[model samples]
Target: MISATTILTFIGMATATYCSRILGYLLLANRVLSPRARAVMDVAPGCVLISVIAPHFVSSRPEEIAALAITLLAASRLSMFPTVVIAMTSLGVLKSVFN
Candidate 1:
């Protein structure tokens, strides 16, 4: 079994990654990034998502991927609070059932 600490670390890292995106936008409005760096940033999100999600999908079982896909789809239309509620509940249920 994956230790809770390992799971927590992964969640923490993902959260930090998301927080850094908001920080980048906030800092960008106040200051400027280099043109070269800005160009890279513009094309980064798709690459980053594919890189992260690809292996996650590969490693996860079908039910895990199904829940993740549903979360991703719903997140487009859902508010942050509801999204969090749904995601947490779904993950808790799925993990409990599977593991």
Candidate 2:
């Protein structure tokens, strides 16, 4: 069973993530950004994604490495929702096959 602590942790993490994503938009809502600044903002999420997944590149497990490659490819070629779906599906399959 999930403990109360675990559930609260999940909630806290969710809130933090949501706030981080929205905070920048809120702060800049009244300002006009230059083209360069807009471009940087657009790619900020990808940078966050890279930071989260970069450590997995050093993983010794073949499944994890393969899944990361698949995720990178999907992220490059597809939208965020489809990329997440493909990444999750590929990781699940790769883990089962490798194990």
Q: What TM-score does each of the candidates earn?
A: 0.52, 0.70
State the lDDT of candidate 2 residue by residue for 1-99, as single tens digits.
335674565355445445655887998899999999988877765565566568889999998899999999998899755775676678668877887
Assess candidate 2 and give its TM-score to the true structure: 0.70
**Deviation in Å, model 2, residue 37 alpha carbon:** 1.2
- For model 2, the stretches where C-alpha displacement exceeds 4 angstroms are 1-21
Clashing residue pairs found in predicted model 2: none
- What are the Cα lDDT values of the candidates? 0.61, 0.72
What is the alpha-carbon lDDT for the whole of candidate 2?
Answer: 0.72
Worst 10 residues of 1 by lDDT: 44-53
Per-residue lDDT for 79 in model 2? 73
